[model samples]
Target: MTDYYGILGVDRDTSFDEIKKVYRKLAREFHPDVNPDPKASDKFKEITTAYEILSDPEKRQRYDLGGDPFSQFSGGQNFGFGDIMDAFFGGGGGNRGPRARMRAGQDALIRVELDLAEACFGAERELNLETAVACEKCSGSGCAPGTKPNVCAICKGRGETQQVTRSIIGQVMTSRPCAACQGYGSVISDACNECAGDGRVRSRKSIPIKIPAGVETGNRIQMSGAGEVGPGGGPAGDIYVEIVELPHDFLVRDGNDLHISIVIPMTSAALGTKVSVETLDGSREVAIKSGFISGETIILKDLGMNKLRGHGRGNLIVHVEVTTPNKLNKEQEELLKSLAKSRGESQDDVEIHHRGGAHSSGFFGRFRDAFNR
Candidate 1:
């Protein structure tokens, strides 16, 4: 007699949970999929057979009494981990009954490119795609003209065939999907010619989609029942529109915020000015304060991208860049020199101070001040 407890590395007095734990561990170790050793498959089968008997209360009690449990079965029986799992986890092991011919279609995904402005304000788009749809000729029945499907005669509508075999334990009966019915319990006597008995056909369709405001890249919008129709005219799956944001000429997006850079001449930055700025909505006048330093930022509230699934909008951040006159004429050069002398900036030894009265001073005052802060 083989010691089932020793084979699973568990004691005879071990609890069912402990035995199951050890069995699972050994099963993974000796499984044919994990271990390529030819002998490992036989070892896994032995382990599974032991678990199948020991996990059952009646079978275990009979084994404990020195009775031959294999003698109780007249025909071959299926015993494996799948049986153990089904006993404990409420799952069906082998012979899962007939399979449904019609099933829900799979979800489909399509990429859509949108400009920055369109994404911010929302837009409508027309899309064309090819997908499976229910056949109109037979009304998705998969039957030709006046004929319909008939129950399988071989398996008697059970969708499975059983075979008896002799093994070491006893005679084992194994059931497999019926070849005639293909597990559907029925056979198509006369298949529809239009869809070739699939009950669905590939078709080109034009659909209108409404893109919501504030959708960003990688976001997906789902449209229910807009995808492919399943075989046998099952319910259609959903269609997902994946957003792909295109690069804008002057705008860059960060979350709900919009960022843009504007270049201004040194005079305009120093003396202050108003400039016409082009925004997604329209052109607006932006005020540039006097003495505005390069790299300074100005925020315009409610002028950015729209918020997704919420009210209001984000702010637009404007970065300013000051440009010095590189090709100054002789007159301009002399005027700058005169202005430099007026500010006592002609001499290199002249001391400069930041507006905050910080220790940093001179031409690099702003840089040092930024670091000090």
Candidate 2:
């Protein structure tokens, strides 16, 4: 006797629910249509037979008692049409008729590069792509200029055929897609030469797309009906435009905020000055406060990228980097030396500034002091 439980990889005392679950998983895995392995058909049959006997209460009882229940049926007993149909169709009862030749097209994706300014503000651009488009010669029909498709005689326009097979379980009837018309219920006479009867041709097309404001890298914009046309000239799918932001020369974007660094002379920082900065909107003047230090950040509100799908805008952050004079003339050196002596200090004796009454020393400490001020 064959052990149905072992075949299904389950315990002998397993419940019906568990056995059904295992059978379904194994059946789908080993089904001939899903798994192309040469032995898959035989394995599927084995799993089906095991499930059939174990799932029936009477058959299971007889099998558990070491009796073959199938032996009780004589050769004179005949299987009903519904029983045979159920065995082949899995209880679907009837056929589903012909399938449609034309189907909805598939969506496509392409990446486009955008400048930082273009991403900050909305823009319209043209894109070129190669995809399947409807054939102009046949007007989206698979037939030639003068002829049309005709009904298939083999399937009588039903697109399927019935067959009977004798197996160990008895005679079973099944229906399969007809080969004559390829399940389309019709055959094209004199197929279109331009599209090879598929009703579509591969061609390059240019389309205009609108990019909204504040679009960042990795953002996707959907363009409807811009994808490949279906095989039989069906509906066109959507084309997704993926945004790739190009590196900016002066700005670094983080979310909706923009950051930039600028260098100012030590004298300009101490005396206060105004400098022109190239922003996304345009060139604007930014004021440097007196006694400005390196690493100090100045925020310009509403000067950054626009908020995506929102109303407000982000701020532009400016980091000040004070530039020290690399070369000094003798007169300049003398003047600096005199100024330092007047402040009660020498070039060798560096003054350490305290912040919030906290005494700290080093480059990092000076950086912290700069920001603290």
Candidate 3:
């Protein structure tokens, strides 16, 4: 008698929902799709069957009463020693082998680099990749040219062999893949020279890939049927193209928003001006407002990268840095001093002159002060 709770690694008093959750989690972890381990797949199937039986009130009650629920004439009774398999697989018999060679191949992964703008706006590129493709000369068959496979004598074309043996405890019976044909039910006397016994050959392939807009680093793009070709001409696996972003000179991307910074003359800070700036779309003039404080941000709406998902676009934030004039001449200094006198102020008013002075209020004012000397 198998302990249902022990099989699922759960407490005896665990709730039905908890049992289901644990079973699903473990099943997903050990599923052939993820683990691909034969032993793990069997364990997962066992646990799944246990949960299915125990989670049902009637089935659990019947099992608890020890009524010999498994019937020899029923679907589960003779299902190969009362071992009920999952619906995802075939019946009690082992998987049938091909007359020739047959098996699917593995997928492949390739890394690609994209510029910030190209990644944001989406772009097309050609990829040179190496993978296993079906052998054209043999048409993915392991048999040599103009030849075919022969039935295995061990299993008589059944792909499996059954044996009965007497042990110390009692007599036992088991069925397994035929050794002569390795369960393929057939033997290839002359294998394909190109791919040897297997029906696949290694070769370089050129593929076109389209990267969607707003794709970030480490993102993956999947191409179906682009991976290694399956054995015996079976369906191909998938190809995953991983994205890597290149650092931009003037732009820093954060999700959807774009951050840009540039230095301008000090005079532009005092007086209004329009400076031409480069953006992904093209060059455009951004207004430098009158008395524009250093480090002030100018947000250009709908000018950033297109949203990776959803509608609309992100904002482009421009950070301004005021560049003060250097190498002042005597006449220039004198004119500045005269202008300061006319304005009824001197260099002592430096604190008050800058919008980001110590006495300034508001968030922008403080932010500007933090950015300046």
What is the per-residue lDDT of model 3 for residues 332-355, given as tens digits with 9 covering 90 to 100? 889778977897886875645344
Question: How many clashes in each candidate?
Answer: 5, 0, 0
Candidate 2 per-residue C-alpha lDDT over 1-373 given as tens digits, one digit per residue, 9 for 90 to 100: 7887788888867787677767767865764323445466467657766776676667668878898845433210111011212233344545577655554567898898999999999787888888888676765556676566677889988889889999999999998999998887777767989998887899998877789999998999875556877766555677789999998877878788887778899999989999998788888899998999766778899999999999999989887889988799999999888988997897787888656433234533554454444
Comparing candidate 1 with candidate 2, which one achieves the higher TM-score?
A: 1
Error of 1 at 224 (Å): 1.0
Return the candidate ranking by TM-score, descending: 1, 2, 3
Looking at model 2, residue 204 earns an lDDT score of: 91
Better structure of 1 and 2 per lDDT: 1
**Cα lDDT tens digits for candidate 1, 1-373:** 8898788878889898777777767766764323545566578668877886687776788888987655433211222123333332234445476654655667899999999998998988887999888777754557675566688899888888899999999999999999998987878888889998887899997878889999999999976567777776554777799999998878777788887778999999999999877778787799999998877778888999999989999988777778998998999999998998987785668776556633234423543343344
Query: Where is model 1 more than 4 Å wrong at Cα?
Result: 1-95, 168-170, 354-373
The residue ranges of model 3 lying beyond 4 angstroms of the native Cα positions read 1-101, 145-147, 154-185, 309-311, 346-373
State how far residue 204 of model 1 sits from its true place (Å): 1.5
Q: Please list the C-alpha lDDT of all candidates, in the order they appear.
A: 0.74, 0.73, 0.69
What TM-score goes with each of the models? Answer: 0.68, 0.62, 0.61
Clashing pairs in 1: 75-171, 76-171, 76-172, 76-173, 77-172
